[model samples]
Target: MSFSIIFFFVFFVSILFCFSNSDEVYVINTNGTKIIGRKFFTVFEDKPYAAFWKIPYAAPPVGKLRYKPPNPLRWLDKPVYNYSIPYNESCASGRTEDCLYLSIYTPIIKHIFDFPVVVWIHEDAHKHSPDFLIDEEVIVVTISLRTSIFGFLNTGDEFAGGNMGAKDILTALRWIRDNIGHFSGDINKVTVFGSESTAPIVASLLVSAAGEDLFQRVIIQGGSALSPADYRNYNFEIMNKLYWNLDGPFEKFNRTKLYELLSKSSTKKLLVASYDLFDSTEVRDNQRLINSFPLTVELSGKGAFMNKFPLEVYKRKITNNAVEVMIGYTNLDSLHKLDGFVRNRKLLKYLNYNFQYLLPFEGRRDEYGSKLYKKIRRKIMDFYFVNGTVGERSLRRFAKYMSDQVIYPILRQATLHSQVSCNNVYLYRFTYQGSFSLVWNTVLRNLNFSGATSGDEICYQFKCKSLSTAYNAEETSNERLFIKKMARLLGNFAKHGNPTPHSSDDILDGLQWLPLNPAKSVRLLNMGRELKMIKLPEAKRMEFWTQLRNEFFPDRRINDEL
Candidate 1:
């Protein structure tokens, strides 16, 4: 036989062999709609589990449906769904625009019923696998949502009410509520997990009235709605820029014209224009990170995701009040920011001269040279940099400044939630340094950094495909033990709404993670080599931010001014 024929024969045989031991499983929802899944085993532990992949939660948002909220998928005639097909073919022949599917992985252990569910929301869902969480005997889910222009483009009018990404998540949650029970999942025990970019979305959900009673708990990492990059208010101006980039006339470009141009443009054209706009846009000092189409606040609309700023929602006590929360950041979460300063000397020199640019605009976007802005800038430079010079010598200080940009918003959310809500709010800081750190191994490998960076702890929670080989090589190390402990903590939270509900739990080393204390010092759980409960790390820096907020912007507004 030819070499190509031999390879194909071997591949086909291997595929058959993989599924030989597996069996098909069927579930019927409350509406009498039946769906098919498969029972399989984990790669590492060989633990039996069931997976339902490419299950449609909403109709495909294609053509005119682009930039619009997801429409709930209708199951007419109680159709029987065979979702065991290949991933690409199941998602409408692998079209990106028609990829609104969710995959569920549940433990099939004997006599085990109603496993707690964890719905993971992230931009890159392909990199994650349910191997580790499934071994923990929990039902894990990952959903794909619209992103970039399709997800977040806001025309500030009814045509494109904005925040389609958030709307997609809410829709998926509603679907889970109606159908997850058939998959042996406890809908009441749902916990939404968001890491990095998705963290802000979860934060927004926590404060949006439309998200009430959707999920009972949330775990946020490395991002928050309080961050400047969380939302955009200049909707019309940004839409005009996008339209002009597409070769459309900018004159008289109202929301109607903008909507017409966007809806008629091909996906390829929209994607190219979005890429060019994202690439050429200049970063503002107010923005810690630049995102092309961030979430937008809808002042008035039917079924609006967010009708006001998250801060305002918190002040009015009109958000979800009963959901437990676990929020934190890595010790060196923003270490990647140092890579730019290390490579570009001129960028550092300019920042040293114009130090005010380092501080977030907060409520002072147009007040750069104002006395209060200058004073706050001077204080920040004095604390983070000596002699007001930013160079290689101040790299660590710069990292701290950038890290605070991430830490402050997250910590602020925790404290604010604790003050208003009646549920327990747990806080943690991931400080474990190991060979499997995602940000280090991928980008800042040569930096010689000593702590975990942003998204470093996700691999320990899930068996990411890209890092599976490395994880296998270190299967026998202390890191493996740490992974078990982390999983236990998370699983315990999902099961009981508390990480350390029992004092004698050995996997956690009997450490009791205390919740945030609005009346006193903010308690924190440090997830380092030795797991322990301690006072917040860098307490002085947190105090400084608290004092700054009280001194200049006590309102804690999410806009340019209170």
Candidate 2:
């Protein structure tokens, strides 16, 4: 062959070799379908492991199934494989019907030894899309489900049942039990974990009959059952009114008409209308209006759902010894108090002004306003560390109130309940301020007040690739240590159904995890590495929560005393 031809041949072969090595292939289980996934490597136990991303576990929940429970697909037919980029559609924001899908991440090649499964439910206050739960190690699965109206609409009729979102979770669990073994996962060693709003739902499941036996381990971070009182006051009457108002009459408000109207409306409009009766402010602001309803209302709604059909299968409590539960909150979880309207002065003033007149307790409006302001400020400090911003003064007060009424009480209850219910229950308070940069950001001039707010912790827990990008250098180092601690605890729990080795010292410290025993629950405050377990002054914790509950939700029956 000519020298030029030989040179071209060698170059072509070299390019092919590089391209082939760069790509990773995945094989479908049935009928030999195959596709190439992006190849990435991560260091695991000093060994490199390959990972594949975005494997689907359920058919898209678009169109007719939009507001309904998830129906996972079976791979019974020939594997229909295409290398086309997998579905990464952003979750339906307002009233989207196209938000059904699940993603899977696993080691490229499964070994004979089965690995534990860690399924994460992403937290967007349960509003955002499902792409947030992408982790490379231990098989990670996340599914998109209906949020807002489609998920939790309470028509207050036998036909309008709540828990469509929860039913989605059940479907995902059943899928795991039936198919995860094929991925070299032990069906029995599944752990479910999430933060914020997701945490509360998971906790509810732990206590509810519907959630029994769905997973062997559960972790709740930063959220509890102490939701707002307004959420529960869902006016099913409003749904009927809006349905008729939009469709023009009852004859047109049938399922077909309802679906047609829903299909035509924007996701935002649907959410606003769905929650208009519960809180007009939420509708005006386009926030999660229904979610802002009273916690008492939510508990009652859940109870009603449970009463309608006893989850017979889930009620058979298979030994309280069967599952391991870990519940915790951040050292400064009150930071979330600043998440919404507090950031906007106009909105705050508007809400304060409106409430001053519309609310029956007009005289106490200033007190409520002050309380909300304090919570915002404290949340700013706890999450971002920098205060002294434009809204700092108001936010500080809001943060304080939130800490006293929401964060502390919720953590205390979880700790107490777990301790009393299961010997294996473990509780923790993440006091580590993470990296110094993160701490510095809390104080950095213009930049300091700009970033690092509540919900920032999520940046580190999942999808973070570098400590530098994740947090400040010094703070990143601290965060690394903290992550290590968290991962160790999680891994240990998955392995033995206990958070740490069965040692007396560990057990003692574990036991000291602030009890929820209404009379003696302690709130563990972690400062740096030091831990201080302080008993919540009995009068403050119980009395305050009781008063708050009664004042906020007089018509509803709620277990807020805890």
Candidate 3:
């Protein structure tokens, strides 16, 4: 046989046998409608669980639907056919825009209606495989939705609204409520969780009237609605400028004209245009054109970002009781990101030139630089660095300043707010080092420094093939034990609303994970040779930064003032 024919025949046979040999099937009903699903092996043993993949939860947001709120999944009379969950196709090519899909992985069913659901929401990134926690007896879901310009672009008026991203998440949760039960899952007892960028999205859902009724628990790791400033007042001036720069004729120079041209462009075209304009735009001290772009403010419309500022949402909720919350950050989450900024040999000079980049802008840079900014900077510098230091000392201080100033304040604020409003909050710091060192030293060759950076601990939750290779036959390391142990704790939390199950036969060995105390403490996970709770070391420094941030931004104000 020819080589081409041989290859094609082999590929076809492999695909056919893979699906037919090891597949578990079931039918689920939603509102008298029936849909089919297939089960796959999870981290658990021989007992396999079910999965319904690539299920559409919303109407496609294309053309005029762009920048508008997502409509719920319009069902058809005929039952829909689905295959094993495929790789998330949303933004799959870094361009496709119709990715409003969610997949459910339910544990082996003993009873049809007996399991808590955990919904995963993140921007752009999606986990496409059979999920973890199948053994923990909870259903895990991954939601793939719109993000970037496709989700956030907006006009100040009602013609084009913003925050389509947050709205998409809300739509997904509603779909889950209407349909999750059919898949051997619980709808009312859902825990919504997100890591890094998506944590803000989960945080926004906490205040949402529609979302609040849907989910009961939330887990925010490394981001929050209050700390990262999730939503901002839409700047009409900036909006107009964005359209003007979208490779359209700007000589006519009118918002309406530019907006029409933008609306006509494809999602890919607009995304490309954004990239070009984003780099050229001179960002303010506090924001990046794209990175710090917050969910759009919708003052009088549907799901407005608390009428103006993100802080407004939190300020209003301080008195209102909310759902259970688990919030935390890694020990040195922001350090690696800061490494790129400290390339210049003269560290102090680098700071003088880029201190604005390192810190969130509380006021205009000119106002900040000309006044008390220096005194505050001096205090920070003295704490993190000696008056004169260079090379190794300088590098370590740079990392510390970035971690202590940029990351910790936000973490402390989120944990404290959750405790006050929700009454139950758990804080943690991921200090596991051994799991990540191999990836850094060999795979990435990042030899400069190593510790728990942002998103480092996520490998434990997702079945990462590369990380798994770190443990082959005959290797029992602390990292492996911690991963399994922590997974049990987190999975137990999803199953029982508490990581340490109260049942006498506690699966997690009765690990007593205490909640955040008056001191705003955190339960340290994999800290050096020990895993225990510690009073968050940065609380004092965080308190100082929080006061400083409030003085400049002001909880009542929408924008910063000198």
Top of the candidates by TM-score = 1
lDDT for model 3 comes to 0.61
Question: How well does candidate 3 match the true structure in TM-score terms?
Answer: 0.84
Error (Å) of candidate 1 at residue 465 is: 1.0
What is the alpha-carbon lDDT for the whole of candidate 1?
0.76
Determine which window of 10 residues in candidate 3 has minimal summed lDDT. Answer: 280-289
lDDT per residue for candidate 1 within 471-533, as digits (tens), equals 657454778778888888889889899998998987776888888778888779999889888
Rank candidates by lDDT, best first.
1, 3, 2
lDDT of 3 by residue, 475-541 (tens): 5355555556666766766766677656353444555777755453444433444566677666665
**Candidate 1 residue-wise lDDT at 286:** 47
Q: Give the lDDT of residue 75 in candidate 2.
A: 55
Considering TM-score, where higher is better, how would the candidates rank from best to worst? Answer: 1, 3, 2
| lDDT for predicted candidate 2 compared with the true structure | 0.48
The 0-to-1 C-alpha lDDT of every candidate, in the order given, reads 0.76, 0.48, 0.61
- Against the true structure, what is each candidate's TM-score? 0.88, 0.67, 0.84
Report the number of the highest-lDDT candidate. 1
TM-score-superior candidate, 1 or 2: 1
